[model samples]
Target: MPDRDPLIRVTAMPADTNPYGGVFGGWLMSQMALGAGSLASRVGKGKAVVVSATDFAFPGAMAVGDELSVYCEIAATGTTSLTITAEGIARERNGEATVKVAQGTFKFVLLDENDRPREVAL
Candidate 1:
């Protein structure tokens, strides 16, 4: 795992909450996917498709006032695919410390304009 900056950061909003008022797991997963996809696309130098989510774990809960951030970096590059690890962390609005909420490793394959697989640049 290499050191890199966060890929996406957004506040927990009411719209993203479940009936229990906590952030939804599916919503968090989507954000993680988007973050990983963005990094993979940039590395692939084109669009990419999520082939698989290797590992996904939720270690903490998220609330409305939490500041959530998704950090991602390239883990490996295949002939036509790139793998990235994404982590989600949340910090309380009143605190500076952040807690890891969830993490997952996703594989993305480069795609052409017609949504077909293409050889990645790297």
Candidate 2:
């Protein structure tokens, strides 16, 4: 794991694996999205919805029972949107080894009560 705190952490279970028994790429992306969305909501101080996601890459792999940690940080802030960079790290189930399994960037638009895009405070 990195020196900074992770936005979210969870274990990879058998249900999250692909047919070949490796962790599914979609599952890792979903975890990254969840972490980014959480950060967006907290920083925006209101509802936030994903507008776009890009720069996804899976450079490593993890097996079932491994622990996945997603770290997110704000890359940019617009009038009504935020671009967040997310990294997924996987820790071996029975050892202290860790590796970066996935990385991506996500853009989210802050929303008001009416569900319309609103200005971000910061």
Candidate 3:
């Protein structure tokens, strides 16, 4: 876990697993997207949508009952966009052990009420 609070946290359920009975990678990536999107919107102070997602990696595995926590941080900023990095950590169901499961970078463009790209205040 990070020193700061996680942007998103949830437990893996049976439905979130693959046919092999392991937690699905897509599910983890979606959680990372949600976390990165939250930070983008909060920092942009308006609507923000992902333009691209890249550099995704899965370094560990988790079971259905494991808990997942996603942490995000701004990595860079552009005139109208933000690049955020997200990390996923999984904790054992009934223990304190934790391991990093996934990581990715997402680029987003801030949007105005018209849904057009707008300058980021940063």
| Highest lDDT model number | 2
Arrange candidates, best TM-score first: 2, 3, 1
lDDT of 2 by residue, 16-120 (tens): 999999999999999999999999999999999998999999999999999999999999999999999999999999999999999999999999999999999
Off by over 4 Å in 2: none
Predictions in order: lDDT:
0.86, 0.97, 0.95
* Between candidates 1 and 2, the TM-score winner: 2
Assess candidate 2 and give its lDDT. 0.97
Candidate 1 pairs with clashing backbones: none
- Model 3 alpha-carbon drift over 4 Å, by segment: none
Reference-based lDDT, residue 103, model 1 = 94
User: What are the models' TM-scores?
Assistant: 0.90, 0.98, 0.97
lDDT of 3 by residue, 62-100 (tens): 998999999999999999999999999999999989999
**What TM-score would candidate 1 get against the native?**
0.90
For each candidate in turn, give its C-alpha RMSD to the true structure in angstroms: 2.3, 0.6, 0.7
Candidate with top TM-score is 2
Better TM-score candidate (1, 3): 3
- The candidate 1 region of ten consecutive residues with least summed lDDT is 1-10
